[model samples]
Target: MTMPAFALDYLPLGAPDFSKIKETDYLPAFEKAIKQNREEVNKIVANKAKPTFENTVLAYEKSGVELDRVSNVFFALVSAHKTPVIAETEKKVMPMLTELQNEISFNKELFKKVKYVYDHQLKKLKGEDKRLTEELYKSFVRSGALLSDEKMERMKQINLRIADLQQEWGTLLPNATNNSVIWVNSKEELAGLSEADIAQCKKDAESRGGYTPYAIVIVNTTQQAILSSLDNRNLRRRVYEASRHRADGTRQFNTFPLVVEIAKLRAEMGELMGYNNYASYSLEKTMAKNSDNVYNFLKQLIAEYTPKAQAETKAIEDYAKKQMGTDFKLQPYDRFYYSAKMKQEMLNISDDEVKPYFNIDSVIVNGVFYAAHRVYGLNFVQRTDIPTYHPDMKVYEVHDKDGKLLALFYSDPYRRPTKRGGAWMSAFAKQSGLRQQLPIIYNVTNYAKAPEGQPTLITWDEVTTLFHEFGHALHGMLSNCKYNTLSGTAVARDFVEMPSQFNETFASIPEIFDHYAKHAVTGEPMPADLKEKMLKSISFQQAYALGENLAATCLDLAWHHLSSKEIPTANEAANFEVEALKKIGLYDEQVPPRYSTSYFNHVWGGGYAAGYYSYLWTDVLACNVAEAFQKFGVLKPETGNAFRQKVLSRGNTKDQMEMFTDFTGMKTPDSSGFLKYRGL
Candidate 1:
């Protein structure tokens, strides 16, 4: 009920001086929010009325609105705009956040109230509220709310330790990448790599590895770009192994011990809650419903994608062998080199030739921002008034028709040593009806940093990725919900990805592409012939991209859906993936999972955990949803507004399927749409 007289109070209400952020202020702000949240939680628990959906569930939803607001901004900035002081602050607060979650999930009196209502109150409710009640009840139960005192204590310890390990996992990924070095002796060995990439490798090498060392910085993945492009097999192997063995190596950053501990703790927690595995515990409220549906979905995709994947691998092997004029087994490093080369030969399309048109600024202003403006009657103008934590940050004001303020957008585009490697969209401000708030969204991507004079040209894939992330931002910006938890991107994990992945379709659309695909120096629109090739080029390597992603999804499900006693060890888990992929016939030494087990941030570090399959599941929805637009025209305001109303604005207030049907007028997705888009 109290408001602060600070710049943070109103985002885009005026210019914010971001440089003024102090480490001292966060602890106080965070502590106050936590105390306030607990008070709200107390009101819910101590309410005089018998537990009812409105009194209990909605009260619980409203309880943490302020904390969610403060913590989301604080944590997002901690990761994206980190200083050592802020990082230390994050270290301090994470355990506190973990404890708060434990308090709510393990509240006995609250559980009893919720259970009574769940068993007796459902008949009194109908439609979405009923589903919401059931979901809230099951979440508490699955989180071990009903456990006896002894087991509850153990579950608390396990949950807290897992939270600690997750922090360890995220913190180490960037550390390993920032710390590791691969020194190059000669330019000859770095044959196929671009000068920009080579220069970066050299700078990193000189900084960390070489005698004036030219170390290529590590990315969190099994295969490295230097691995594929470098002619030296030994160097390639070293790079591949370095990236693969990250945090699991014999150094202090090792997470192998932590991984086993987290798994064991999760299983123990599962048993306490009466679930057989973590997936069962985690999936109680997810779109997949339970492990069986999730398993079946993964298996079906594996069966369908494996053959196409294997054939693609065989083609790569054939290319590598003929090029080498000898028989040598293709290893992980050989994959990307051969795949890119093969695409150039087969489709006459190379990313290098395509990259010129996709300079980052053009893609944002002309591509992403333009599409959003045209489709939704919104516009973006850059802001310097708001303070950002970093010099690299760019802020935007998003406005709807009649110049009504809609959202705030920020982007951090170039790679930095402080940043963890990869792309993600997150919120500094989430939309909510409780506070009458609008979204303030931030997206971060770790593209190769442009040198002093170079333009920030991006690969075609990266272009799509930008559009994809912004789609999630759009979902955030457009949200209209009564609760913070249900607003914007707060839907079920399996359904959360639908908006983002669906936005990727716009990146390659003829209308959107032509607007943004201007040459950096020439300022000329991308030639139509080249544009056609680029549009067609998007699908050129579908087999490899599809297979790698599917492998990771399947592997995630397989590892997490285990019976406690059957949980596979890391080595055993890797072998299982090999066999599993082989069974689906996609198993090729040349095509590894997009994320290797050790480095899978989704499960171990990020929120996805057992839920990475959400990407694939949502891809099906994305494919189907694209058809809605194709049928009614891509920029059709009628269709767009309908979807925005039904799906975007509805958030977690209704069943996702109901929302989808409301927009598409169908309960089941058009399955062939997914296949057609993937070239299956």
Candidate 2:
């Protein structure tokens, strides 16, 4: 059988021939890759000699190379450029991949060989070798290797069903979001938005065949960014309601039923594994260690956040009442608009004033890349010869200060109908010294594109997001690990966000900020007073930011913490979410969760399931690291190198906390940094 072009290795590591690859190639490529992987595994199982660290552990680690390569490209496209064909391909391919995983996990002979090395030879191994042995053993146990025959069979079925449900939820939620666009017949309804914004809405409507003259597309989050600028109260309500109910059973593409089923199945899997709930099973290897610890940490923060949030809401309400008569009442849609208005009035800063300085290209080159060069001695040279999956993507060759080719970086920085909302960092190939593979890292964002021939200006929040995603890229690009399994951003969910969040601190630093925050038209730096106002207002809306996030995190926990019997029906999903928020003291009508249950793709579809609190958990770690950088001078190369060595490059080879202590000189990460950073 001839290997598909997509499945073959590229001459330059990690660069796929994207121009030749088609949606039709994915299924065949996956089938061949899986077969190749199974054969490699079979070789290890058939070895007659006694298992050793090299033969058993390393062989298993190296076995699925082709499959991983195919999967990396396939899934990246599915998320970043999902057309109808790609979506259909995902529905067919996911089950086959899941079954392959189960086969590897449940192979009694393979497990015996891996266990033999883990039990007898692990003590002799050192550093990454030992860590790999331990991780491999634990992975087998987590995959039901120790279960009875009946339970193992049942686990296989559960895994298959869960995979299907996750794919369904992932597909349904994004379609629902796209379909929920609010089409306004006239520009009068869009009076509050800027001319550029209004133009973009018109363009969106025209792109969708002009169902209406203007269209407001719903983003992935429960709170849409447009809410902050919209003037008409009724339009704001319409947009907010569209976002809030996008994936409810009432919608054409519903995910409520899928959410309930996934939760119940996860609960059953947890029970089979002898855990109280899915959260317990999931958190066992994370830094938080257990659900109780996560709950306690959230509880501590909630006690402080609730009062601050109440005061914040009261202030916004007071402002709203003054603006519109005394009888005016605040609603969820009013929060962003009033918050922005109050900030503009109080601090004399607005997104409109800040956006001109944040032209998308300048932010990428002069801002994000500049900081990388200053701290990490890295440089990016754009490559036009490389083929990309989309025209919006730009490829760059990343070079170290020593002039050696380090990695390939790709950037996709615009919103499209097919692209999902929010931003993320992923790789077509992860760094591995053993495989001699260089990382091919890409960052995908959903910032609205500018009109033809117009310069793209992004919000300050989006600028921070750009920097945040690059932090994850750096983690992958600078990885020094030998094994692919432990390389790059493959750390604990609770710890992985630390790198990304810590990177955000760089976006506001004066040295870097001045370079990138130039007016798109004039190329002039922002005026000193304007810069001061913008910097001063960084902590302006901490209550809403923290409140929405905590509500979502708590909502994630509420679903996963339930036993099988406690799982709600599809009809009760909304009520369950309301009660969950109320129980956690996060039930504010004016400040909903960053994601509601029905449209909470992060929990349901994204791998976050019970792990959404990781953003808060790692924010603490990130702030602590940020404080350390401040102590050492934020742009100091010495501090950056130390972090790259201690954290980013280390990957999962060392203990996560130990890596933190090694760099920060603190045994425990300080929670005070989080409070100080958020201005609570």
Candidate 3:
């Protein structure tokens, strides 16, 4: 009965001893943790005493401590740094975990007690107590606790299958992306790329066994970043096609089959839960409340933005024609390259001109952390004594305004072959007053690394990404919730993105931008005119940005809005995506979805299934909040503290919209902020 290294609490809390964790330890840790969790639940269920708030709801909230700890570390490693052993471990452990969840949810005695507490003590309980009791009861119902024995059994099966399918899709994507790299044998094909970029390509080639002189590694998105820089049209087309077709059946790690299976299974799961489709079931607890609202929101934006997007495309196309002669027809591969050219010509700015001021280290320390320090009176000190899972990671101890240690922050900013694409924030431990735990948060990004001894310069997009992810980290770090279930980023899907997106507003603020955007080698600030041009160019591609996002959101809705009978087959998935986009009037070959269906990890593998619209939904709230900040002085500590108290720290303890209203002094969020923020 010895506790595994991962299951045991670190002496200081928040910091896991990564050195003691092994590839072999995960399975055993999961097994022991699951057993321990089951025993704890049994203890509550077997209690002969009358069910009360303390004996039932609170007990359930705290029951799975060991399991949560083990699962957190295991899953964090699996996503951020997966190996064959971890992948195999996930395959075994996911089903076991799902089965354990079913057992708890369907425990008749446990549900009866939870129901008793919720029903009888409902009005007597107040604040988080009332909220937790209600939430726990609803959670049990959502897990099919209210179903008949027969239906519950079927529900359990569907849950297991869905989990398996999601895991399969998740496992396939990174390999698919890695395998989808476009190799170029000649240096001539890599023209227009910087020396640093070419060096990184060679490094990537060497890392992948050196079959080619250079390799353009495909990212998780439909559009490859290199498309904006590569001079060779054929090479650009090759990279773009590889990105779009990644994880399709044409690739070694095809996820098309898994996508079809997962979507259909999810629809079936929703039907069992008495919902029309998965989107209904999933959006029940989100701020959007239902699929209709989400659709309406997206459609309104689509109608407004489509004309603008087309106009933007026409402008770029005209510019391309002027440069390459009227015979040039702009394709998807040509979008980014010509858009960059048009942007430079129109706005007198380019990513290269701006990137020198955005050294990754400076952006993090001077830009992201500096913004936090100014607004929230927080400070970050590097903790080199701590161990990390990867050498690229740096750990910092965060201190609050009062000089008390608040949280531990971990930054993983470089891309590697094993690491997944995109950026995210997660926690090793979440803050909770009840549990007396401080947050241990990490932000992971896929910024391409510079060669050793070279300062890593990032584009403005990556710079904003650092701030955005840290916004989620700040949510965790600033949490003042009493219950573990209601802490940190545990709010509604739609509401959770608000804090992160709101954090992005600071990235462009003059005070913070000037602090972070320093010359990498010269250690000097950007010239004033150049800064103005960079700032003005923010809205230069608003059409394409909004168009891609709208397409992806619409695609998410299309898949989840379907009933089981309407779900597409594996082979039909690609065509289904195109048709869905066309139906929504977003089927631009030049402006594809931010993520295509086969490799849409957020929907198929990640927890965002039927919920990717949260980005757009929450942007409404973020923009309104940003407007409020702008009115009250963006860098004012008073404004920061108000937001920290009213929004970030509150977590899921209150209604999300109510929390927003409380901070912004508005009855409803103003959607006008969306257009204003986008500069449309």
The digit string of per-residue lDDT tens for model 3 on 1-680 reads 12333464453655777876678887988899999999999999999999999999999987887888888878888889998898899999999999999899899999999999988999999999999998999999999999989989999999899888888777788889888888899888899898888998999899998898888888767887778898999999888888888788564677888888888888988999999999999999888889788888888898899888888889889989998998989999999999998888888899989899999999999999999999999999999988888999999999998999999999998888768889999998888788778888999999888988989998888888889999999999999999989999999998899999999999999899899888999999999999999999988878888888889988999999999999988889999999999998989987899999988888888889888998988888899999899888899999999999999999899998899989899988889658768888
- Span of ten consecutive residues with least summed lDDT in model 3: 1-10
lDDT of 2 by residue, 155-249 (tens): 99999999999988777778888889899999998987999999999998998889999999988688888999999999999999998888884
Sort the predicted structures by lDDT, highest score first.
2, 3, 1
lDDT values, one for every candidate? 0.77, 0.91, 0.88
Cα-lDDT of candidate 1: 0.77
TM-score, structure 2 vs. true: 0.98
| Worst 10-residue lDDT window, candidate 1 | 1-10
For residue 393, model 1's alpha carbon misses the true position, in angstroms, by: 0.9
- TM-score-superior candidate, 1 or 3: 3
Candidate closest to the true structure, highest lDDT = 2
Question: Candidate 3 — which residues are off by over 4 angstroms?
Answer: 1-11
Return model 2's CA RMSD, one decimal. 1.7
Q: Give the lowest summed-lDDT range of ten residues in model 2.
A: 1-10
TM-score of each: 0.92, 0.98, 0.98
In model 2, what lDDT does residue 680 have?
Answer: 73
Clashing pairs in 3: none
TM-score of 1: 0.92
